[model samples]
Target: MSDSGLPDGFADLDPFVADWALPTRAQRYEARLSKPYDDLVSFYDAVAPRAEEAIAYLNGLDINDLPDDAEKLLQLLYSMILVSYAVNVFKQNRIPDSGAAFFDMVAEPAV
Candidate 1:
């Protein structure tokens, strides 16, 4: 097990530890990338198609099905980690909300 660089209270985020420790820009430029990082990138690419499937699965859930504690996972999947990778790395700006209340908490979108 690696030191996650996170505090103890945020245990639910442990699953994301491997993805989070990916090489920085300098490291990638220097070709000091680890095999695990490359594997993770490949894994995410392989699973890219499943994002929509996951979204559809989420849509299938009823309000009652989601326990109140799901907020942490929601934020982890949305605001914290994913947007950076989607927008910056994958070059996608528009996030598909699929007529859901996706941007409710966000401010106005810039033109």
Candidate 2:
């Protein structure tokens, strides 16, 4: 956790574009592309479901229960969240309106 009481995962994930990747992915279907951030909340809402699923999947997980791949998954998820935040700030300009929804959900996919 940071100075705030948020758990490590909470700090690392992108509140925006949480599960918004699917549509954003589809919106750019067939195009060679960079990530989008224009409406941070929009993307977050779009992808929120994926995050929720991820959380539900991860809930109650114990370190011993994790597979060998668990560590890698954690790193990947953190990296993706950072990337999503950066994409939003530099490319999308600000968090989309749906950022709140993104936060409401607890899990997200790796980029």
Candidate 3:
């Protein structure tokens, strides 16, 4: 693992696009997984901050005019949103009505 807590290939990723490199929690928990469990946890911790930055950037883009590359990233951000829901709402018992939100917020077209 590198100083960022992520393994080598992951530490240098563009923070906004790092989601493509992160393994979902489900993957880490898979029965047949080969990687060390500790490595998975470390990677998750390292990627969490980058994922937040990515989500924020994606939230500011207009969905209709998004670039092709960004479209994939947008989908990845949505997956992160689902993970947020699981952690905050389900595991932490947070009320959806109180703080629920989505990352994608398309800007209004100029008049």
Candidate 4:
């Protein structure tokens, strides 16, 4: 594994791990809102192409007990989901015309 803790095949994503591999929905959401649209686009463009491959790689593992590197990769994927909305629909960091609007997730599936 690389110093970023991502698996070998995903080393290219290491540069994004610190900022994008957020461990929770709230964190990812905050990150999405904090970054500029271009940043989101950069992340989306880099990771979207490898998404399928990442999913397939992760599918063989036990979701509840992913290894450290794998867990980071999973978090990165989660962030990608958040970025998709900005890149594909909203075209901005936050939701359009939804100022100061947010919700707390009372429950979320374990990663």
TM agreement with the true structure for every prediction? 0.31, 0.33, 0.35, 0.95
Tens digits of per-residue lDDT, candidate 2, 1-111, equal: 422322445434434322322323323221112444444445444444355645554565775565433333343334345445545554543345655342233344432
Instruction: Give all candidates' CA lDDT scores.
Output: 0.39, 0.41, 0.43, 0.90
TM-score, ranked from best to worst: 4, 3, 2, 1
Regions of candidate 4 where Cα sits further than 4 Å from its true position: none
Candidate 4 residue pairs that clash: none
lDDT, model 4, position 70 = 90
Each candidate's root-mean-square deviation in Å? 12.5, 13.3, 10.8, 1.0
Number of the candidate with higher lDDT, 1 or 2: 2
lDDT of 4 by residue, 5-58 (tens): 998899889989999998789889889988888999999999999999999999
Stretches off by above 4 angstroms in model 2 are 1-49, 92-111
Q: Once superposed on the true structure, which residue ranges of model 3 sit more than 4 Å away at CA?
A: 1-11, 14-34, 64-68, 71-111
- Arrange candidates, best lDDT first: 4, 3, 2, 1
